[model samples]
Target: MIDDDAVGGTRSQTDVVIGGIKQMLTSGALVPGSRLPIEKDLATQLGVSRGSLREGVRALATLGVLETRQGDGTYVTALDPGNLLSPLGFLADLQQPAHAADLLAVRRILETESVALAATRLSETELAELEAILAAVDDSLQADAEMDLESFIDADTRFHRTIARASGNPPLAAVIDTLVGRTFRARLWRAISHRGSVRETQAEHRAILDELVRRDSERARIRMAVHLLGVEEFSAAHADEDPEAS
Candidate 1:
């Protein structure tokens, strides 16, 4: 019985319902963990059909802004910007090969700043942990004559994540975390397919770590930028040759 016009009307109503909920959040009338009014009552209040209201609620839930409990109710989430924005990882994963360079450019911008901040803010214990991570990376490299791609990638991710955490900004760390997650798979593939890249990347990581340990914020920032840019260049070159690799 649902015609095209009916579907269009429902979509519009869904948007209105979404807007109303956003406004409530903005006005602080609906804080984190606040249970929404029952579905029927909320639909009536928003002057929307239950179907439209449900669609909007489902969308919000998917974005991590809301959570629904069976037999309980939907409630606003903790509203952590990090949680809400995690879907960016999916977008990053879906990016076409042509967009690889663009993604790396963003990583360079964020990670340069993060490394600079980490140089100044990282404590002795944190520095020690980073050293251990790199040491493990080295050990993994020696584990096999060829190269242990999986182990290296794990250590690589841990190294960057530790630095991000050391930067002392939760939001920035969260963003960098997502970017790293999105790109690490491609990075691993690039390393596996290209000879000498593994060693080169390990050297670069060591240099960046040295700068961080020296507490030279500017040097750490520059080294980090250079390291990421090298990866970007490698990806660009290979992507042109094999557009379907990643």
Candidate 2:
């Protein structure tokens, strides 16, 4: 329980409630999956009204720090990277298409390093899987027919995501996944407006995968950077293009 004197400082009651719970967490009084104390008792312990405590709890729930079961009670969450960073995708989705260049810039920095790591860490089976993804891309591009936008996009998403996961870094992979999901519409818009853009991107994916297969970390990083930089430049040039329309 929080100290009685923990509340009633210059801070708002909600802050007090939040801070008290934080203190309990840090002091090992709480752990992942620990059930919170009863509402009235916790309210009294924090020296705050039950309403204020509820407000604080709601805020924590939004942040993925806690979960309230339908009839069981509130408890601490596992606090994994996916849970904590889940809000990032939601926020990124709300940004204007004009901001895609900004998002891609960040993506480039993270993915370049991730690909470098993946060059050394990926398994033989994973390498074969990547080749298969690009093989599908090749088939998609070989025909004179109009591109299947959804098929191309799915392949594009899987290729990069496989590399990110192979980097052997869970948190990094989670963040890259979020960024990739957010940038989907911008990529689709580019493919629609820029003739042969899909072919260009597919070629770049081949280059990156080739470097990874060779286990050349430096070249893999370079290839990945160059690939994303092209997308960033294209997105930046068309700042007014609303990808949502595609």
Candidate 3:
């Protein structure tokens, strides 16, 4: 639960400015791409000192709610999900390895549904594009005795990103991308320490593509679940072995 003072109760002058701006935003008085009132005007309106209002504006700017231009005044941002939810990646990065399973579990729930949606939505051209991405993965796998880890990870990111975007939900795709990107270090460690992981991942990707090709949402969902679950289990089993986990 959030602290009572944090949500309500006695507040600081900066909080007043933040709350005032939030009220404007929620009541449709302020909108995306709209310029904010000048600092003196806004400070007077909010009944706060200019310093407090400036601090509040800085806080919102950090949260992707507003932006300041060089010559132009401050303006509301487009409020894109990718920008709004970027902090999720920061939180994910702070999780200890013990919490990796929990993080991946959430991802599994979101991405299974994402893939199911993508199955029916992906265009023929998009399907071919996904195939090409997998072919790149194959090339990375066969590149040398030591797999080209950078190339392989790049392909892995693209494969999941393509499917997530094809789900036709920008917010969902953004969340999935945040989760996937944060877990990438763990995935890299798994591939390096566990032989045959590359091959196993390759097979799983093929299975998902097959289901997508058939436009079978349920089967695609199941395949995606199994694939993510494997990662969760692997992380749980090997967390102690990962120096990065510490």
Candidates in order: C-alpha RMSD to true structure: 4.2, 2.8, 3.4
State residue 183's C-alpha deviation in candidate 3, in Å.
6.3
Per-residue lDDT, model 2, residue 97, is: 69
Identify the candidate with maximal lDDT: 2
lDDT of 1 by residue, 55-103 (tens): 9999999989899999999999998867986887876677666677788
Candidate 2 minimal-lDDT segment of 10 residues: 185-194
Model 2 spans with C-alpha error above 4 angstroms: 1-10, 143-145, 186-193
Top candidate when judged by TM-score against the true structure: 3
- Can you write out model 2's per-residue Cα lDDT over 1-246, one digit (the tens) per residue? 454444336677888888888988999999999999999999998888999999999999998998999899999999777778877886567667678789889999999999999999999999999999999878767774457777777788889889999999989998988866735544545534445678888889999988998999999999999998988888788778766554
Q: Which stretches of model 1 miss by more than 4 angstroms?
A: 1-11, 182-184, 191-193, 243-246
Candidate 3 Cα outliers beyond 4 Å, as residue runs: 1-9, 143-145, 182-193, 243-246
- Clash total of candidate 2: 0
Q: lDDT (CA) for every model shown?
A: 0.81, 0.84, 0.83
